[model samples]
Target: SDRKFKEILSKSIHDGHKIYEWLDTDEKLKLTRQLAHSVKLIYYLKLQQQLWQDYYDLGIKDGVWAPRISK
Candidate 1:
């Protein structure tokens, strides 16, 4: 829904490569590590959401003492 995302993607692919021409090797490594960390964080967040979804779907704890879950 946001055009900013498209612009950022386009700019990164088309014009972002220019930065590497003068960037230091250490800086590049750091940037790549940051990207990898970001990906791993997103993966864990998705897994956490899925785990909650699985718990809700199972409904095995629907006893009188169990907390009620609303739609």
Candidate 2:
């Protein structure tokens, strides 16, 4: 599952135009759920705590930047 998630994420980032064009709303939701589940698993593993912390920080930053970016 982790491997599949990473593969999708990598494809999204590396070939975003093609990926986004092909991905539908349901597929996007499924991917989001998969990513959230993966994050929970990583938290349980206790090996990616700092990475999770950084992701949280970035989420905060993105929220702050979102309004400006949307314009």
Candidate 3:
């Protein structure tokens, strides 16, 4: 399932379109939800990467993972 999701994401990223080819309407909705979830995670990781870099630059070794203040 993870590999399949990665494949879809890679194709979508390269092609600049939704990854819903060959799927029925219901299946397309489900795939859309899955893709949205994956996108959220990717956004989160990118934000975290930026935060880590900022912290490292400031020499901050420890900090709490506060969701409300993340963005």
Candidate 4:
């Protein structure tokens, strides 16, 4: 799954470069907004993956633990 995710991320980034080379100014503005949203989505996915990893490392077998963020 991680490999697949990496492949998709790589392809998306490559496609972004291609788009940037061709799109006009107006389109680039719209793309900038979309890219900002995508960054947030990526952040959320990484946070989720880290939470799952922490749970696994803690030997949380039962689906009863609530994940909390550490400052």
Where model 4 places Cα greater than 4 Å from the true spot, the runs are: 1-26, 60-71
TM-score of each: 0.51, 0.32, 0.48, 0.45
Per-residue lDDT, model 1, residue 68, is 70
Per-residue CA lDDT of candidate 2, range 1-71, in tens? 54465456656575655544444466675877677689889877786777777777897888843333553
Error of 3 at 16 (Å): 17
Of the two candidates 1 and 3, the one with more favorable lDDT, higher being better, is 3
lDDT of 4 by residue, 1-71 (tens): 33343344446675654543444366564666577579989999999999988888676557566556699
Name the candidate, 1 or 2, with the larger TM-score value.
1
Model 4 reaches what TM-score against the true structure? 0.45
What's the lDDT for candidate 3?
0.65
How do the residues 1-71 of candidate 1 rate in per-residue lDDT, one tens digit apiece? 12343344446665754544534366664675577579889999999999987787666555424557799
Go through the candidates in order and give each one's C-alpha lDDT: 0.62, 0.64, 0.65, 0.63
Q: lDDT at 32 for candidate 2?
A: 73
lDDT of 3 by residue, 1-71 (tens): 64475466657675534443534366665776687889899999999999987877566435444334554
Q: Point out where model 1 deviates above 4 Å.
A: 1-24, 60-71
Judging by TM-score against the true structure, name the best candidate.
Answer: 1
List runs of model 2 lying over 4 Å from the truth.
1-24, 47-71
Q: Could you tell me the TM-score of candidate 1? A: 0.51
